[model samples]
Target: MFKGNFIQNLPKIYGTYTGGFLAFIILMAIAENAGVSKETIGILFVAFTVCIYAIIGYLSRTVQVDAYYVAGRQVPTVFNGMATAADWMSGASFVAMAGGIYFGGYTYMAFLIGWTGGYVLVSSLLAPYLRKFGCYTVPDFIGTRYGGNLARFCAVVVLALASFTYVTAQINATGTIASRALQIPFELGVWVGLVSILLCSMLGGMRAVTWTQVAQYIVLIIAYLIPVFWISSSGNYGIFPHLMLGDEVAKLGELEATFGLKENSKEAMAAMTFADGSPVKGLKYIVNSHAGVPDGAMAAWKFISLVICMMVGTASLPHILMRYFTTPSVKAARKSVAWSLFFIALLYTSAPMLATVSKLSLMDPSLATGIIGKSIAEVQSIDWYQAWNAQKWMHIQDFDNDGKLALNEFFMRGDIVVLATPEIAGLPYVISGLVAAGGMAAAMSTADGLILAIANALSHDIYFKIIDPKADVRKRLLVARALLVVIGAAGAFVASMKLTSILGAVAWAFDFAMSGLFFPLVLGVWWKRATRQGAIAGMIAGLGSGTIYLYMVKFAENANENIILGIDHLRFGIIGASVCFVVMVVVSLMTPEPDKATQDMIDEVRVPSGKTVLGKQH
Candidate 1:
């Protein structure tokens, strides 16, 4: 599908992508400076992003099997890197990360460390080998390497489970960002997002998703960086927020103290009035409120557990790993991972910094003084309060009879940190719109990858491989497209349920992936002795144990009192992954070794450069 100079053309493509983004920014800035209404500009910003990505999807549309499955296995290293970054970033990294950092504080660094460091596993242990294996999907690698219909079916089940969970979160993020940005109902927003995802993914599969993600990465990175840069410059931190976040952190602590914002204290827990004038308890931002561990060592243990889960989960996620399969070669896969980390690190390092700055700005004495002594009516009249209040993301009530806004009177959801940062920092509404559009890009990009992963697993692994082995390219492509719509709709419906925060849902999906797929996938490539029986058993044990434990602790009887060894449900992936690893090792030792043919296949994949079978076209 592609010949020489594919890599050389990537820089020009990126330049064009950057130029398009800049043009959008300039257009939005012009409208903003011309005094266009913020609401109008925000809607236009979101609409423009969706429409442009849809255009990219249309242009990249392909009916060929190679293009649909792995973008013809010809994506260049740098563009592949950008696409992987976009796929990896997701709504969690773009929208919810700063929010997580804002509420979770120091402990939230786990997400940063886990997600970024996971690429190390990808480069060193996963990507190169998988690319060399020359498979269309993660399950393909498993089925081909291990042999047997049972192995292929089991891999499909795990892939579907993990990808479904992951796609739901990404869709949820899409709805969250769209609802807030477009001023639409969340239910409607979710459907809107579903349409956008289908537009991109249903057209060209991996090919469309790849190009769209590259475009999305540009939008998201710029959207994330601009606000951080603005906030830093505004706070006199110069352009480098990471280097000077210490002062802001200290200032935030001081401001919290001055406002009498003690953790779990009555002052911080003062009851507040809802928009309808009904009274309810105020929200708590205390770190220990949901920590489930009071002691430092226990908290550290929980944090480390989550970090391990995220790291392994990132490496385990099918959509993320699927990106490597699109690259031209094993060496390109390795190089792409390095570039992915470089692109991702730009946002990863800045998230905590933005979180710190946002907290300081929110808790600043000046804003506190302006609101502290104000009536409910007066607080409602405030711009930031009114804007966010309209979305019900923020609520304030004068708890005391003194008719003054106290620290307890102010309540905002964690999600507001990123959404409201531009407004909070006095940036123009255009910047806010751009940020919102950026969030959409992040959500849509990840959703594209996830939907493609699930669709491929179903259409390729299950339907074409087992249900209809005689199916041709046309039939296979249609099956994938049809399944994509079904899966996309299901994701949107689940997302509309609003089960949890963006980060929480994403973490759970990560946990599921790590639990079910991590051990089998990793060992399948690295361990020649890893048998089919072992892979199947390991997946079942890991998924079953993790699911049961999470249910017991999160939704079962006496769930609140059911923490295992002081471990939270979010950190349950470590338990699952551990069980899978042990089970795989034990089962492999007990079972017959893999055949000589399988060993030869493994040896070939171990190499970094080679032509290998991909499909009939190859």
Candidate 2:
């Protein structure tokens, strides 16, 4: 009865929590206006929000295997949608997405389109069916569907590779936010973020992550929206900036022209130098450059290929698919996907507005005009410049030897754009603090889901299912918790190494997932004839081919000259997925079909009205 009431009243409960959080923000704003130090406000914002999530994690802790694995399969639809949205946003979406748009212009909209469109694939093709199949993990589904340790083990490998890569990006995002908010080194910030992430997920697992993500979604969306709203209302763009993106973008392009920031302009292509007289590598800033593709002839192909990878990858990602397993039923799972899309759209639609307005804020002559012609000493003395400069996020060197700064003389890391926007716009320090907390929440929420996905795959699929099928719940839970710590620490270490930009790493993860798992998972559900042998062969072929291509393009000299159909590293998934489909189809045709029982189970998954096929296992 208590559980029933708790679930029934979740909407009201979260509403009250949202209201209280707003009140807290208001109080903090008041403190800031009353002369509270910026550092203190930053610390307070991060500390307060993290403590709240930690407390939720603590309260939601469960020792039961079912709850730990799948939130006892009782999560409400609306809250689950919110949790899924929080999990989906990640550090890449919150921190680096706008920056990607600001730098790459219309080309980066592929990400927004692909990611959002992926959820439609989820709703129609995967989510409800997976819920009906009643799996705790994606690997669990693969293991059960194909009926072999080898197939399951292969799935776990793919899950680990993709989830680990994705988690590192999330940790990188956390490190970026922490370095700015806490004034710590980026390396130390990675561990700091890891600790908060572990606190939220180490105990109750899925249940803890679910509730905490709801809280995070609130913070992240509010944090994301406030500054955009503030900046938009302050400008001629008005309060609803998303509707005015065209005007703002046109204005931004004008500023780029005024500053000679066009991609083809000599000023943009000029060499630059650091403050220490060392030559800075390549053009760091280009107005409206198409990302990854070189020739105009290949732009459409590259764009379409990228969208395909992201869309399929979205469906293939194990951490995301696992969200549907927490829902109460297949019907609820489908509904949850709809709600997830709605929640996600709120942020997705606003990202471009944030990007356009943020760029305008820094460029508009009526607004941050001094930057283009300002003397080095003068610009260095500005508060936002000094703060970001201290962290090495922004740099300026008058490469032309003029005392005043040229547009090309300035360089800023794209990862810091969202985090530094409030400060750049000269908003209250409290808003910066709020954005930091929001960024942390975004990173931590995704990290929690991703780490859980990896750890669960190892503990449940590899350890318990294959090595010790007789293991008790306690032992299984113990193994999972321990793996969580190890995997998270490993991710933090990789993140500290700074392998790639946050968005770059995320794209790689998506491509990797799509390459290896998309065809197998989709085929497993939709094509009953997909034999275990075919699935295994497809996984190896797809992942192996994609990985080799990625290595060549990224590491080998002259590799770009031979790229197949202009498929760069970001679009390797297209080739891999295509190869997997062909290989899987051919192999399955050559192999014997699945036994009748397996075919029936596949049929059972498609129906929406029955109890979960594997529900009794728990």
Judging by TM-score against the true structure, name the best candidate. Answer: 2
Root-mean-square deviation of Cα positions for candidate 2 versus the true structure, in angstroms = 2.7
| RMSD after CA superposition, every candidate | 3.2, 2.7
Question: Taking the tens digit of each residue's C-alpha lDDT, what string does model 2 give over 525-595?
Answer: 99989999999999999999889889888778998885878788888888788888899899999999999
Candidate 1: worst 10 consecutive residues by lDDT? 284-293
- Runs with alpha carbons beyond 4 Å of true place in candidate 1: 1-8, 265-272, 277-295, 366-380, 397-408, 613-618
TM for candidate 2 is 0.94
Q: Estimate each model's TM-score.
A: 0.93, 0.94
Task: Report the C-alpha displacement of residue 350, candidate 2, in angstroms.
Answer: 0.8
